[model samples]
Target: MIKVLFFAKYRELLGLGQMTVELHSTTTVADLKNRLVKEGGDHWAQALLADNTLCAVNQTIAHDGDAIADGDEVAFYPPVTGG
Candidate 1:
């Protein structure tokens, strides 16, 4: 299973801190996002839009093509903003 974590506005929007997902070997970060949108509903789906959200896989920023594996930690958050 892959451990999925949500942070910042994304966490608040989903009302969840984390989830464990069963995935195939070929699954990618984009695929995971699609599944999260399904499990988390419109708020999460909308928040995860590519232009607005950020993702980290195994604590490193991940691209859509990045591979996912069993027990990987995938974290999601809204884009960060600061002065």
Candidate 2:
């Protein structure tokens, strides 16, 4: 299973900080985001916009094509803001 973490508004929408998914070797970051969008419906769709959202795999930010494997940890969040 690949562990997934959601932060900020995403966490609130999903009511979860983390989850685990079983995916095939062919799975990519883009695929995972699609799955989240499907599961979370309209609300998650907005937060998961590819251009605005960010993803990390194993604590390192990853691109859309990055391959995901079992036991990997993935996190998603929006861009941060600071004073």
Candidate 3:
């Protein structure tokens, strides 16, 4: 399974901090995101599909194309701003 996490604004938006997805060899970060959007419906699509949304894989910032593996943790959060 791929452990998916939501943080900060995304966590509030999604109403859950973490969830698991079935592991598939061909799955990439984008694919997993799209799956979540489908399952979570319209609300999820707004939070996850936003342009400023960011993703990390196993604690490392990742691109949409990054491949996922069993037991990997994927995190999603909105971009942060500092004064």
TM-score of each: 0.86, 0.85, 0.91
Clash pairs of candidate 2?
none
Give the per-residue lDDT digits (tens) of candidate 1, residues 1-83: 88989887878887888888887676988888887778767887777865968889999999888999888899988887878
**Which consecutive 10 residues in model 2 have the weakest lDDT in total?**
43-52
C-alpha lDDT values of all predictions: 0.83, 0.85, 0.88
Worst 10-residue stretch by lDDT in candidate 3?
20-29
Give the clashing pairs for model 1: none
What TM-score number comes out for model 3?
Answer: 0.91
Q: TM-score order of candidates, best first?
A: 3, 1, 2
Compared with the true structure, model 2 gives a TM-score of 0.85
Assess candidate 1 and give its TM-score to the true structure: 0.86
Tens-digit lDDT track for model 3 on 1-83? 87899988889888899998887676888998899999889879988899988999999999889998899999998997768
Model 1: lDDT of residue 25: 71
**How far is each candidate from the true structure, as Cα RMSD in Å?**
1.7, 1.7, 1.3
Instruction: Select the stronger candidate by TM-score from 1 and 3.
Output: 3
